[model samples]
Target chain A: MNGKYRILLPVLSLTVLLAAVFYLQPRAMSYFGLNLLFNLAVPIALATIAQMMIIMVNDIDLSVGTFVSFVACVTATFLNDAPLIGVAILLASILAYAAIGALIHIRQLPAIVVTLGMSFVWGGLAVLLLPSPGGAAPAWIRTVMTVKPPLVPMAVVACILIAGLTHLLIMRSSTGTLLRAVGGNAQAVARSGWSVTKLKAGAYALAGVFGVLAGVCLVGLTTSADANIALRYTLLSIAGVILGGGEFTGGRVSPVGAVLGALTLALAGSFLSFMRLSPDWQIGAQGAILILVLAVRLIFSRRGRKWKGAENG
Target chain B: MNTKAKLLGAAALVAVTLPGHAVADTADKRIALSNNYAGNSWRQAMLESWAKVGDKAVEDGVVAAADAFTTSENQATEQAAQIQNMILQGYDAIVVNAASPTALNGAIKEACDAGITVVSFDGIVTEPCAWRIAVDFKEMGRQQVEYLAGRLPDGGNLLEIRGLAGVFVDDEIHAGIEEGVAEFPKFKIVGSVHGDWAQDVAQKAVAGVLPSLPEISGVVTQGGDGYGAAQAIKAAGRDMPIIVMGNRQDEMKWWAEARDENGYETLSLSIAPGVGTLALWVAQQVLDGAEVPKDLTVPFLKVTQDTLDETLAATPEGSVANVEYSQEDAKSVIAAAK
Candidate 1:
């Protein structure tokens, strides 16, 4: 496969999905229609980016979903009533993520086991904070999430901003290169006198930052928080990363592609709803669409490899 | 009039007094509640009601212990595992609010095979061995349409806000609404959307679909979506339609405000969260060797226009209106089922 063209896969898939959605529901072409269609995309994109950061270091954070829910609960409850304490707690959570990363590196612990355990911790905290799904989102966050810009919807604008900023941070910067190197060949990087522990910890801290943003944006859009609100996001984020040309073990990831993959996923749900599929088959249909997209990507990559082989021959 | 006749009379007397004495037999039995999810206000209220009633029952010596355990994830496999744990813990009876109607049947059957009384409610299992305490969700949906038909005699276009798709409750209620429309030929369903039984999701769905829908005369909903429909319709600057509500406190509060402002009228109905307690007592009764039928029906809670204020006052803010059933109520329900 052509390394330079890898990012096009997510963009192509996203464009195809957008076209299908607009074709099926012409009303969705309008600004209001587009807003409603993609209103929930921002948080998903942020979560995907967060997952991408963890994947970049060849470590998965299984607790990303519940951690996001925890942040959302805090954002809606303490953040709404007592802003200072909420901010402090959020900062402490980020530090905690960094500490976990350091601990994993120091003790040679399995990332999956540690994170799987942490998921329950975060989930329990969220439930304790808000036993029920009733907490007011801070007024400013709600306004910002619902704000209408000039032409495109806020969802689109947010997606673009997230893509661009994450791309710069993860793909275009020296620090990001070091982070990826830590995943790619930690021994080599460590032999060169670069502190692998700090880089891995930094990667986790960055993920925590994105996870917080995802939760805040989610609560802003939903206007309330629930302990189970973003539980689906764990799988969704992993899917988005993979759909966006990310590998499981490699440090290879695309921030822009991850954002587009999230957008595509969000649009896929709307497209199915617009198609008016039978309720019995709706969830199955969603799985089918995912399979179809991944299959297409597989075919494209295989064809690319063939072309490259022919050129080498 | 001899000794044989006198012995028959004494046996009749014992039988007549057995209702009150049966409670003593179940005093040593332990019951466990295996709930699938507690993420929403409705579920939170349900758990609270179980605690309130279960604690009292334990104190009154009706049961040895009534412990409640909820799975973190609302998955059938997780809940099935929880049920298996309860079985291993030696619970005499298991009360289940299952995640799936059929997925937990295996676990439920295992409990029954182990000689444990299994009473399933709300999200009831389909296992014949387990006693089911189910609300007629179909009737709940039909009643909403009936209320609308009464309000708008000349039925116009109606929008349907449904619960989570792929759920049995959603399908049953949708079928009932379809049946209601068929019965009232004048009424036509113009638009339908899945609300996932959450206010925010419903609000988003309604807002999205409202752009293309015609002027609706009424909105029929499953529980927990009335306020969302109202918000969406209001935001679109449409004339207020008669939207039947699920017995959510926010919905009732909004209805009350609308009524005070413009005399808005609608119907609200849902199964009380306290149905958990009813299932609890039913489990105890079965453990006490009461001949409880295999299936029992729980009455859905309804709030009419006249009773809206009263219901709203009784419901805590952000919670659903509920009724906690006493042991006597459970006995009556069992008798009614028989």
Candidate 2:
């Protein structure tokens, strides 16, 4: 598959889904309707980007969901009441992620096992921080998320900004090249006078930053936080990355595609609701849409490979 | 019929004489609570109720140990594994708030086969081997509409806010609402959305559908979603409707303020979070050799315009209105069931 056009698949999938939603409920084409349908997409896109960062370094973060929930808990409670302490704790948590990355590199540990264990740690901390799910999001964040822009909704604007900035930081930067090189060929990159450990740690820290943003955005939309608020994001973010033309172990990721994937997934839920399917099949219908998109991506990638083979022959 | 009556008579006799003797019989038995999720305020309150009642029972020598365990994720398979662990740990009895009504049957059968007493409540199991203290969720749903029908005799459109989809409770409540709508044909249901039994989720769902919906005269909700619906409706610049509330403190508080401001009136109802303790005492009773019915029903807690203030005062801020059942309360409930 050509790297240049890898992003087309996610874009095509998103466009088709959006068209279906707008067609079924024509009211969704308007500004108010679009905002209502995609209001929650900002946080989801941010989380996907966070997951993409870790994937770019050839590591998976099983703890992203609970880690995000932990961040939301902190943002709603301490960040609302004591801004300095909340900022301090958030920074410390990012440092903790960096340390985990270094430890994994130094000790030759599996990323999956460490992140899986950390999921529980983060979940427990969140539960302790807000046992009953009754903390308000900081006032400023609520205002920022709910602000009415001129044409596009805040959700759409935030998504574009996130995708554009992350693309620059990741796909168009030297540090990103170093990070991918570490994932692609750690020994070769090490021989080139680079610290592989530092690169991995930096990637993880960047992921942590995006994860915090995701949490904050989510709470801003919800107006409160719960310990289990973002527990589904771990799988959702992974799915978004895969849907956006990311490989499992090759450090192959596309930032623009990931944001589009997140938007597609969020819109799919609204699509199902608008269809008014029986409640029994609503959840199953969501699974079917996910599978349908992935199957399309699969067919396209296969065709791309076959075309490449024919050209070479 | 004769045999059934005979069994009932024998159960009543046992109940009359077993209170004092049952304590001694169950003193050495250890019990475990297998809860599936604790991510919400209702669940947090439920767990607190269990600890309070279970610890008191232990100190009073009703049982040797009563420990609680909860799964991190609300998945049936994980909860099944937890139940198996309880069986291996040799708990004499297990009281559970199950994740699924049927998915946990296999693990529950194993416990029954191991001669362990099982009592399921709230999110009750369907396994015949286990005893169930089930809520009449359908009746709870029906009564919400029944109240609306009474309040507004000239029927109008209702917006039904359901709980998590594909769960037994959600389906039962929905069926009840449908039944209510059928019985009162003048009252129509124009829209419905699954709130997943959380305020934030409910608010989002209601807001999404409100744009496309007709003016709703009443909102029929499965608990934990009334306030969210109110907020969404208010935001949409619509007239306030009578929204049936789940007994969350926030909802009750909102109801109180609305009443003070504009003389708002509505009904609030839910199963008390402390129903876990009732299941606990039932397990202890079963282990004490009392002949108990396979199925039992617990009444849903309801708050009317008259009782709102008193209930609000009793419920802690950010928690559900709750009532922890004592041993005597459990005995009476069991007696009533028999």
DockQ of each: 0.01, 0.02
Candidate 2 per-residue C-alpha lDDT over A207-247 given as tens digits, one digit per residue, 9 for 90 to 100: 89999999898777666676877777898799899888887
Spell out the clash pairs found in candidate 1: none
The lowest-lDDT stretch of 10 consecutive residues in candidate 1 chain A is A273-282
For model 2, residues B1-338, the per-residue Cα lDDT tens digits are 99999999998688658646677678899999988888778788999999999999999988999988876558553456467556655689999998756546656766787799999998887778999999888888899889999999999999999999877789999999999999888899999999998899999999999989887899999988999999999999999999999999999999999999999999999999899999999999899888899899887888889999999999998888998998888888889998
Model 2 chain B poorest 10 in a row by lDDT: B72-81
Q: Evaluate candidate 1 and give its CAPRI docking class based on DockQ.
A: incorrect
Task: Identify the CAPRI category of the predicted complex in candidate 2.
Answer: incorrect
Clashing pairs in 2: none
Per residue, candidate 1 scores C-alpha lDDT tens digits across B1-338 of 69999999998678657757866688899998988888778788999999999999999988999988776457553455456556655689999998766546546765787789999998887778999999887888788788888888999999999998877789999999998998888899999999988899999999999999988999999988889989999999999999899898999999999999999888888999999999998998888878899999998888998999989999998888999998889999999987
